[model samples]
Target: VKSGAGYLPVDPSYPADRVEFMLADAAPVAAISWSGRELVLPAGLPVVDIDAVDVSEFDGSVVSDADRVAPLRSSNVAYVIYTSGSTGRPKGVQVPHTTVAKLFANTESVYGFDESDVWTMFHSYAFDFSVWELWGPLLYGGTLVVVDYVTSRSPEQFLELLAAERVTVLNQTPSAFYQLAEADRLASESGRAAELSLRWVVFGGEALELRRLSDWYGRRGDFAPTLVNMYGITETTVHVSHRVLDAALVADASASVVGQAISGLQVFVLDTRLAPVPVGVAGEMYVSGVQLARGYLGQAGLTSTRFVANPFNAGEVLYRTGDVASWNSAGDLEYLGRADDQVKIRGFRIEIGEIESAVLADVSVAQTAV
Candidate 1:
């Protein structure tokens, strides 16, 4: 948004039909693409190939003139991130500049991001997790090593990249980390372990079963490269709650413990009527505060249903997350998966995540889908 233009990151690997559908929904004025990629765009949609941009001939001093300025407002929409809808089509979420700034502004102390760190941009820009992975280093003047597709797919290769680049901050999904941990174990057992410089490994995009990391903890421990599980969604500006995973919590935590809301944001577990549920009671999750997205773009009806007026506040709004959660006795929130993600078995309802967690608890189980 440096040039006051928002970006809608389309998955480079999406099929032509899928790409066209996203283009129609976002209605971006122009598409920006890098070299060596085939893009399918709507009719007459302006496309700019960044590889062909010849800005080298331009005088840097003139374009970088100190007086030449157009400041961006905090309310200005920074990007449009599309999230999957129940109807199959994706709905674009309008995230403002302020919403993004609010995330780091409140959690900078907790994250301890700085200029000395080196991060790897591993996830696709289309995924909201990439927002955290991309901006964390740039905003702090830190170095960012872009992971190639080949390396991203292989845990052994990724581990090699981390050691070669001396990457300090890493973000990954638990599923991906499982293999990497296994690779680390193998390397250690073979007496060929690569020295890692990671200081933090942030997890998101799914519920993390801490018990699965027993072997990893036994090897690396929890003190270094502090492992944190951040519960997040695209509409809520990436993260809703932050929980540092420790040996004690890993052994005791039954469900995914998302911990508490970051400083500026407010997350409440409320009943169907929007009334706050008592401690340890499961209910739908609602988020309120500055980080909330503007709403689903061009989908007024859908926006109204998802983002409703806050019952506790006079004129504020809350984004109904459709997530099931409850507060623990320690006042920390525990994520119980999506509210609508239940399966009926012989007239009894069971959350799919609960079953998945049980299956994952098996030491021999590598992955599961139920």
Candidate 2:
């Protein structure tokens, strides 16, 4: 922010108790909300009513380095996004300016983003994916379209918005994109077609069913809106690896290939002993680099356990992502699934994702959950 203040975005739909809990946990200096929005506020907390402010009266000019009250540092905590705490409470991940900067450090080389691009704020700010979607346009000098809650839930409306705004960059979860693809298919078949200007459709949040994309390719092709699968977590600042999906990779129905690490990020698939496993062997994924978050807000114990000192990189810490994965022969990391998602039944290990994949393989099954 201009004043170097760290913000925590909570879902407006949260219940009174949940909202109050987050407010107490985060302990923000002030609470901001629109006038029309009725929020559950804590007593004695400062409130900033956005709708009441007359922005037209302000200078609206860019401030130079000399005009600032204080110099903004890269180490400053840019935001604190609360994630679903495994323990039942929400834990905040304090993302520093440097981490966010590193996320887009190689935008030109990795993504080729520029001023001409237009990105949509598709995911909620409570989710770490918003960090990428929100800062993407700002860091890359591109346009940002803020999608409302109603339209964001409707795939048909979202697709129409993409066409209307000429959005060049789109980000989505595999589940969300599936719905959009279906909407696109229906529109095309119904002769109510609206050609989109999207150049990239990035995927994250969950494992993608690459085989299901065959229908999408049949209609729009893969090269038009180059599909990319970026795998990552909140503590790692949105994304770790970037892989542009193509027909070749998508042929393998069960393969969830998340390619090489981003420029300033590092990843390793290791065994229980913290030693790197052999290629093609499943292991827990660990990540380290500038993109790593400061840690959970006021959660020292959690900070130490997950963000432990890296055995390989002395003096550095690696965030122990509970994700299970392995390196392919070609140097790409294939996401197996969550470590906990794998269950042992009758002395045999079973990955729920594998079962889900097999069920989804059936043409009659539109969607399946395992």
Q: Could you give candidate 1's per-residue lDDT for residues 1-370 as a string of tens digits?
A: 7656689988868667557777887888888887666665677988788998898996666333244356567787899987655544567899999989898887897987899999999888888888888988889999999999999999999999999999999998888888899999999999988899999999888778888877888888888678999987888899888988888888887898899998888998998777889998999999998899999989999999989999889899999988899999999999887777653321122456656766787899999887
RMSD of 2: 7.8
For candidate 2, list the clashing residue pairs, or say none.
none
TM-score of each: 0.88, 0.88
Whole-model alpha-carbon lDDT for candidate 2: 0.84
C-alpha RMSD by candidate, in order:
7.6, 7.8
Residue 57 local lDDT, model 2? 78
